[model samples]
Target: MMTLLSAPTSPYVRKVMVVAHETGQIDRIDPVFALANPTKANEELNNQNPLAKIPALVTEDGAIFDSRVICEYLDATTSTHPLFPRDGKTRWQALTQQALADGLLDAALSARYELLMRPEDKQWSGWRDAQLAKIERALDRMNTDIPDTLTIGAVGYGCALGYLDFRFPEVDWRAARPALADWFATFSERPSMQATLPRD
Candidate 1:
């Protein structure tokens, strides 16, 4: 079994958990609850991930950091329902869509840190607005063409959208992106997503 540094409310960690469940490899994972937060560094987690992020998988071979890499590793190792497409234009599309969804997450987190983590005196509203703009653009793209297959792109979008709902409910993402919202409403029903919902 592999050890996964996990935090209950971390959307990145939640993404890996959902991937594990979707790939039918959840049993092979041993989740070690860790209270990792952006405000402080975790020495133990840093041992596994130099950047001290959760969802770091300690494998027999070594350690894999970042949810994207870990999720791909799981998909590559699993023979069952692969979340990542193997080849063709569809594969490229899936990878690209995954990047788009991940960008939304990155921007959202950047805004969060700027507004919530930094001291009010040091926080820059311009920087926060810039990040939020990136998220809005990404969401517009996702709404224009939502993923139709259960690929890595879908998984990434699911986690990103869920995180927005969990943290930025005031954004009203559904107001303009009805297609993306509808797609996510259905995706949220998946057992993998249902089991990995982020909680306080």
Candidate 2:
């Protein structure tokens, strides 16, 4: 079995879990909870991943750090269901969607860290607002390009939006983005999304 080093609240970790479940590799992955913070630094995590990021996969061959690399590796391992398309156009669309989803997640995470991790006096309201603006722009673009079918990129986007709701419900993402809200409502019903939902 492969050991997955992950934080329960991390959107990146949740992405890998969602992919694993979607690709039918859930049973093969054993979840290992990790805290990626200055106070909770574990030497084992540093040894596996110098950056000390969550969602690292420890396989029989070696260890893989970062969610993108791990997700591709997992998708390649399975033959029956492919998370990434093999063709040129579809694959590019999926990859592009993944990038957009990642950007949204990055901005959201930055804002979250500013609020929760930094000291009250040290927190930068400007930086948090900038990140929030980026998230809003990304969400707007996503609403314009919302696909009829659920793809891998859509899964990633759904997970990213879900994380925002879980951690920062006060943001009220649904107010102006009714289309995205509807899409997310339907996306949330999937088994993969249900399985990887964030918990306190």
Candidate 3:
């Protein structure tokens, strides 16, 4: 079995887990909790991933870091490439959508870290505001271009929205984007999403 340095609280890790679940590779992955504090060090995780990031998968061949790569790897393991389209326009669209979702997650995480990780005196509201603004812009784009199929893009969107709900409920992303909200509500019902709910 492959080992996954993971923490449920991480949306990126959750994205990997959701892909694993959807691709029927969940049983093959052994999830091991690893705290990935940017300011602190995790010896075990650092050994596998120089970046010291969670969701790093330790395969027999080697280690795979980054959620997007890990999700694609998991999707490739299955005979049917359900999460990723084979080729053509749909493929590029799905991949681009996934990137957008990841971008949203990046900004959201940055905003959270700025407020929670930085010391009171060191915290900068402007930085957090900038990150939050990015999130809002990303959200607007997602609202206009919601994913209509079950692809990596859909999984990424689901995980990102789920993270917002779990951590930044006060943001109220649903109010302005009903269509995207509806899409996510349906997507959240998937077994893959249900199995990999983010937690403390």
- In angstroms, the error of model 1 at 38 is 4.1
Task: Quote the positional error of residue 108 for candidate 1 in Å.
Answer: 0.8
**Tens-place lDDT digits, model 2, residues 1-200:** 99999877888998899888888999999999877875467888988898888889999888997888898888898885566887888788888888898999989888888888898999889999999999889989888877566567887888889988898788888889899899999999999999889987
| Candidate 1 lDDT score relative to the true structure | 0.90
The residue ranges of model 1 lying beyond 4 angstroms of the native Cα positions read none
* Residue-wise C-alpha lDDT for candidate 3, range 1-200, written one tens digit per residue: 99999998999999999888888889999999998999999898999999988889999999998998999899988986578998999999899999999999999989998988999999999999999999999899999988888899999899989999999999989998999999998999999899888878
Candidate 2, residue 11: how far the Cα is off, in Å = 1.1
What is the Cα-based lDDT of residue 94 in candidate 2?
83
Q: What is the C-alpha lDDT of each candidate?
A: 0.90, 0.86, 0.91
Clashes per prediction?
0, 0, 0
Q: Output the better candidate (2/3) by lDDT.
A: 3
**Can you tell me which runs of candidate 2 are displaced by over 4 Å?**
38-40
- In model 1, the Cα lDDT at residue 85 comes to 82
Which residue pairs in candidate 2 collide? none
Q: Give the root-mean-square deviation of each candidate in angstroms.
A: 1.2, 1.5, 0.9
Ranking by lDDT: 3, 1, 2
| lDDT of candidate 1 over 1-200, digit per residue (tens) | 99999987888888899999998999999999876767787888888888877889999999998998999999999898678888898889888988998899989989998877899999889998999999999999999878988999999899999999999999999998889989999999999999999998
